[model samples]
Target: MTTASGGMTTEQLREHVATTLTRGRERTAALIEVEPDELTAQHSTLMSPLVWDYAHIGNQEELWLVRDVGGRDPVRQDIDQMYDAFLNTRASRVALPLLDPTEARDYVRTVRDKVFEVLERSPLAGRRLEEGGFAFGMVAQHEQQHAETMLATHQLRAGAAVLHAPRPPAAVVRLAPEVVVPAGEFVMGTSTEPWALDNERPAHTRNVDGFAIDTAPVTNGRWLQFLLDGGYDRPELWTTVGWAHRVQAGLTAPEFWQLDGDAWSRRAFGVLEPLVDDEPVVHVCFHEAQAYARWAGRRLPTEVEWEKAARHDPATGRSRRWPWGDEDPTAEHANLGQRHLRPAPVGAYPAGASALGVHQLAGDVWEWCDSGFTPHPGFEVFPYEEYSKVFFGGDYAVLRGGSFGTDEVAARGTFRNWDHPVRRQIFTGLRTARDLTAAERG
Candidate 1:
């Protein structure tokens, strides 16, 4: 059997389609507020009205995956009247009767189920492989896009006091200053394998002089030394832009971190807890990472350096889906899947180490790099143009790996995340690197 997304086998197409729907449902349930009269109040500038977004998601899925594919009409065809952003430009302007929260929820589920059934019943052969796959991939990515938007909306609506929870104490593990990357040239991006994102494309080769990266991400214990040395207090350690950001935000330490009677506590997810010495220091923005590196006599690695360290293959210069290998993520390999619901000790997953023996490259938290957000040579925008093109300015920094809350597919090694230096949320952190000359001097 084959699904409407003709490229994938019946099972593969079903899984992809189903997973997208599941994520939408999950995020909507988590973030949307229940209101009397089924009218969702807009609380956050980061989000559209909750009811509008909810209905919009379903309408989008139906339009792209069902109607665009020439499949049956959606179970709730009336949704197109009010929620279709493409068709209903005045949706917010007009006072439309909103779907009952229960009915809205069911509508999302019903559309997904009907789409799945259509795909399951479709014939395998003579399928429009490229077009169908593109349609499915677009909707899948669209839903993921909304997932992020909804998360931001939830945070805005709930306020910092309720949205950010504290993490549990992290286990301490000592780390060496450097892990050697043997001298070699490595393929730095995706090859002609499965679907490759545009930024990962035009897979290129580069020669990397051997160097060392910190064996684990810089930890709370290590960063504390930098802090005590008056790291943030000093202007020399900061870039001019960074210093300006510090003053504007009045950031004395990583966001959510506080000094409490000679000890440290940090606000995470929504609670406050004593700072754990061993966890990778998170909530630090790119500028903070840069400042800390300067103070510590180190620097952030370029994307090439990071990829060379991560994708090193002794023989055939190729990239691995993960730092370790092609195997899907498991809880034992990393602190992802919300298993611990917080960043674990940096060295907890020795198994997830990359080729150069860099640990936690796939999960726990995203590590900021020095590279500007630019396209790889010959890179073109994917179906979702907003994914990387809009953030090409130097204001954004490159972040590798996935965070505790990221889905497993998003955690793949080739996946790239970028954000502004001052916006710290969703488990951002950093590791450090030093020039070979400095390491030799030490």
Candidate 2:
């Protein structure tokens, strides 16, 4: 589909936008209300205060939808500077004279009201921004992205587990360890996906050699073996920068992990829980994933390889919009949104598995790839430069797939996520791949 409003008439488009925007707003409000006032006020260096995100989301909506598209006046011109994410760092945002929670809600509500009016009268089928309601989809996705960010902030906060959900029911899964993605040319990016970020535009063909990818992500039990074997102490196994970072951080295990005598446990959201042996190990940084890959005699899949594994169908010799097919995600498919506070067991989502039988390729944890953040052949900056252009550099490692904290609207197959290799605060992990060599076949 070219856009979320695809196959819809003007009124249907407006209703779709209204529904999506409401989902995002409700989640944002819920997140703000979930935490204690003091916790929401305090800023973590890793994230903006909840209040900042609450208002920043509104500022973005007003800027793009109301002011930019609707040609309306600003809702709160004075607060623009305060909520401008590019203008303020996470550390300083907390110090801003932000609106209280009640006021923030009012501000967003007012912006939304104006937006609905604009949607009602404005033409929905002219220009790139309005054609197929691109702007509306963009804004809703942006808001949902912030809602996921706010959800991450909630996870980073220290408190009781305010977010709750039922455990993912265990499914009968294929225990096969690896699946071979046949070597071939496959499309890597998207031009038809309307809300796809600029970085994922200009879909291009990527040629990858035959390789075997693990059926499931590395599990807590497997990572425990790495720890037992002095994975952190073996400087030789790590890149120079990674080794130095490991030393500087005095790291023995993943963040939120504790090694008490011979036992292992991790802080999930707010409570201490025994690490589930089958769940994909979350909070692993790229460097850690890399080191573990080396230990396993494999390597993190390149972004191209990851996409092929997730989107390409060797049988049909074509690409799919999502791993399971063009269909959007459903609760039966993957663990997503804020519906679950943590990842399900590694082999839990059989229906969500890729065409090649690569499990957990959609959601559970953000899988770290070996590629850095860079644009495709004809990448264009859309909406603004800060969204993707500013972050184009080797400083960031791309992570594919969404996490438990990811909102469904923001977690498409072509969705691109990147972070510093050493960042362990987000829901992150990796699935290792190795080339299928002739010697192995012989």
Candidate 3:
């Protein structure tokens, strides 16, 4: 095997690939520790059955690693079409003949067993996909993404709670209301990250005007204030399309939330709990976030401004891989990997703060940005175009930072996630930003 760049020897690359894939499997397994019926049942039209996701993760692995990279025949040629995401929409998937929970477990284990053999023998060099174990890395990230999706499904599931984790650490320090990001250029996206997806590629420079961003994400307490002030009742706070969506959906508050007499309670993973005032609010769509921002005399930061706050370090004038630094994430850095069932309270994870003193930029709730989903300056289609290319358009709103359910492998500084502006099913929240005043800019 040829020596790989980035100082990763062939052995280290192989180990990393194995570890990444393993973490994904572990999370997927934990999420599906439910009844067989639940595994096959559709929790919501917005997501797939847990069992379908179970085998689909393996099918993708087989297609990319075992067949495409290793030059092997299909393991289950007949089942490929059923698992193709584009071939069948989520709403139609439940009607298809999907593998049973037992069958899915066996098939995925069989495919994974073969995949490891391929990983051990295949050279980690040559073709772009093989170099640095990109295929394996991609597969690992794919599975982790689905794992996060499954976690969201869990949240949507109704019943006694089946998933649990210890609470996230308490707030370590008091945070300022907002941080001033100076006017200047900061690197955006990634040119060096080995596993970065296509949308995060071709690092470029962006010069943004001075702006003030919330030091932490907007919290339940603040959202309560918005509610009390009749923020949703006021149509002027919403955009044309946003107002329409709000009216059609009757969106008076974030999803899963209900007024419990005089207090607000939200359902999470089948458990009902009173609103935690200090926790960053989740299950809010871009419209609600935008409306809330408007009510607060602010707006969501553009993707450029959000990236600059999360990545730019004025002291060194370089963008690190994460808000904290180049180091991989740990328990102390962020509340990731389903470590907590919900977002930690605001001001938590001070260690995860960006160089600009923006707290919780890596994990908690995905922070909605003002920008629509768009390609960077030099975007290119990778291994496949379906991953990102198909989603490029103004219909989607860009969300930065990873949610608590997101895995470290799939969540990073340059990692860009977008969904329809009306989507609130996945864990999402926002922080507000505004242009610096003339005096403040000076």
TM-score of each: 0.80, 0.96, 0.98
- Name the runs in model 3 displaced over 4 angstroms: 1-5
lDDT of 2 by residue, 172-198 (tens): 675688888877799888888777778
Best by lDDT: 3
lDDT string for model 1 (332-369, tens) is 67776444556788667767777667888777778898
lDDT winner, 1 or 2: 2
The 10 consecutive residues of candidate 3 with the worst lDDT sum are: 1-10
Report RMSD (Å) for each prediction in the order shown: 5.0, 1.7, 1.8
Global lDDT of each candidate: 0.68, 0.84, 0.91
> Residue-pair clashes per candidate, as listed?
9, 0, 0
1 versus 3: better TM-score goes to: 3
Judged by TM-score relative to the true structure, which candidate is superior, 2 or 3? 3
Which scores greater on lDDT, model 1 or model 3?
3
How does candidate 2 fare on TM-score? 0.96
Steric clash count of candidate 2: 0
Error of 1 at 168 (Å): 8.2
